[model samples]
Target: MKFAVIVFPGSNCDIDMFHAIKDELGEDVSYVWHDETSLEGFDAILLPGGFSYGDYLRSGAIARFSPIMKAVEEAAAAGKPILGVCNGFQVLLEAGLLPGAMRRNSKLTFICKQTELEVKQGDTMFTQSYEEGESITIPVAHGDGNYYCDEETLKNLQANNQIVFTYKEDINGSIANIAGITNKKGNVLGMMPHPERAVDELLGSADGLKLFQSIVKHWREQHAITS
Candidate 1:
């Protein structure tokens, strides 16, 4: 399936995302500037991590107003897969495409490291390649990666199996150790970990490759059915 890696002014990881999809995942992929008005032909959308708009008014706050986000919203509404990593996750939350919000790390410091995560719901579209409760290592880098949600929302997330990946330990003090989560419909995923950075064994781990494979696998199945 073809994918579009959204590029904002300050986005620095667009190349990493492109390499992961084009080289590692063997998929058609291209960069879509944030100001672009449409996402017409892409089968999936990827928002890579970076300090969009320089993270001036809070991570992802200003970047949400970009013209391309309207197209992203349309894609999500159509049930197309959308994966947002790191600051991209922040943008999803800011855009209200995903629930919860990010806060400063509990330690008030920028952190960058490989973290162990548990697969919470492997049956979902973005995680089907993983076994339930399996442990995988992915790297994370961010200062405002601490995730929080109100109690009611947290309960809903739990009840709906929207929580997909959780940290094995308190890495950033996110509630329930939430490293990643999907929307209620499971079409959109927002996560703090940098899965694109781990698509190869030479990168220290290939665990993140399964996440991308899961997306393509689901798309192929759905395409076969519809076609």
Candidate 2:
């Protein structure tokens, strides 16, 4: 699979994400600068976490206006799989590719540690390797990870099985303890955890690899039948 990792100014995790996909997953991956307006032949696009644009204004607020995001938005609309992590998730919300908004953590502090997350829905390409209700530990680092949405939208998300991951212990006080969510079409996924950081046993956790593996499997299945 050909994967494109978007890189914006102040994006610190793009290299980690690139290594995870290229070195760990052994896939074809490339780094695309934020100024690039074309997606070309990439099979998947990843928006890795970090303080984009130095977190100016709001996290991901400035990065959302980058030229590459227009192509990302268009690809997502066309049903291409897109995964956004941490600040990337914030960018998705700002670009209206995902629902809800992120606010300062309820604790008003930057949290950085391994967090337990429950797989709320496993049907997504991002979480199919996890069983529903299964608990997995992944690392999180952020200050504005509190996810918020109106009651009706929240209800709709739950009803449609759009909620993907939820904190097992309310780490950031996200609404409904949601840690991640998917678009109605299931092509776009956004979450505030750093899955790339947990992809290796050397990192003290391998739970995050399942997410990338799931996507690879999904892509293979799609290609196999078509081929």
Candidate 3:
């Protein structure tokens, strides 16, 4: 599978994402700078975490206007798979690729540690390897990771199975403990945790590899029949 990792100014995790996809998954991966307007020959695009644009205006507010985001939005609209982690998640919300806005952590502190995430919806390609209600440890580091959406929107998201991941414990005061969500079509996913950090047992755990593997496996399955 070919993967593209988007990098904006101040993005620190792009290399980690690159290594996770290329070295760990043994997949073809490339970095797409924020100024680039095209995403050529890539099946999946990832927006890895970090403070984009120095988080000046807001976590992802300014980064949303970057040129590459237009291409990312188009790709996502066309049913291509896209994953956003940390500030990437913030960008998705700012870009309207996903619903809800991130707020300061309930305690107004920067949280950085390995936390457990509960798989709420496993039918999506991102979480298919795990069963619903299963918990997996993934590292989360952010100051504005608390997710908030209006009550009606939250209800709708639940009704549509758009809520994909929730905190296993009430670590952040995210509305409904939501840690991640997907678009209504399930093609775009945005989560706060650092799945790339959990890909290797040497770093900590290998539980996050299932997410990358699941996407590749699904792509292969679809391509096998089409080819």
Candidate 4:
């Protein structure tokens, strides 16, 4: 499968994302600049972590307006899977592609460390490889990662199984300990944790590999790719 790793001016994780897919997963991947107009020929889109636009005015507020975001909207409308990690999650929220908004950590500090997350469900293409209630370790680095949404929205998300992952412990003070979530259509996922950073054993854990594997597996199944 081919993946496009969107790159903004301050996208520090672009290379890491590209490496995860290309080097580790052995997939065709490319770095698509934030100003690019189209995402043609890519099976999936990955919004990597970083302080986009220096996070000057809120984490993803400014970066959401990058020229490539228009194409991102178009791609989302076309039903291509979109995975946003860390600041990417903030971008998705700011762009209105996903539900809820982020707030400063409950502790009012930047958090950087390995976190345990419980897989709530495996219905989406992003988590089909994980079982319900399975716990996995992934690194999270963010200051404004606290997730908040209205009670009604949270209820709806729960009823629809949109909540994908939750922190095993209350680390960031996210509402209901939510660590990750998917769009209503399940093709788009936004999360505070950095899954791409955990795909290698040398780095510590390979738990995040299955998230990518699930994407490729589900995509191939849908496309009937026999190879």
In terms of TM-score, the best-performing candidate is 1
What residue pairs are clashing in model 1?
Answer: none
Clashing pairs in 2: none
Question: What are the TM-scores, per candidate, against the unseen true structure?
Answer: 0.98, 0.98, 0.98, 0.97
Model 1 worst lDDT window (10 residues): 218-227
Candidate 2 residue 138 Cα shift, in angstroms, is 0.4
Write down the TM-score for model 2: 0.98
Report how far residue 34 has shifted in candidate 4, in Å: 0.5
Clashing pairs counted in every model: 0, 0, 0, 0
lDDT, candidate 4, 1-227, per-residue tens:
89999999999999999999988888899999999999999999999999999998899999999999999988888899999999999999999999999999999989999999999987789999988789999999999999999999999899989999999999988999999999898899999999999999998889999999999999999999477
Assess candidate 3 and give its TM-score to the true structure: 0.98
Give the per-residue lDDT of model 2 (tens digit) for 29-94.
999999999998999999999999999999999999999999998999888899999999999999
Q: For candidate 2, which ten residues in a row score worst on lDDT?
A: 218-227
TM-score of candidate 1 to 2 decimals: 0.98
Descending-lDDT candidate ranking: 1, 4, 2, 3
What lDDT score belongs to each candidate, Candidate 1 first? 0.96, 0.93, 0.93, 0.93
Model 1 CA lDDT for position 192: 95
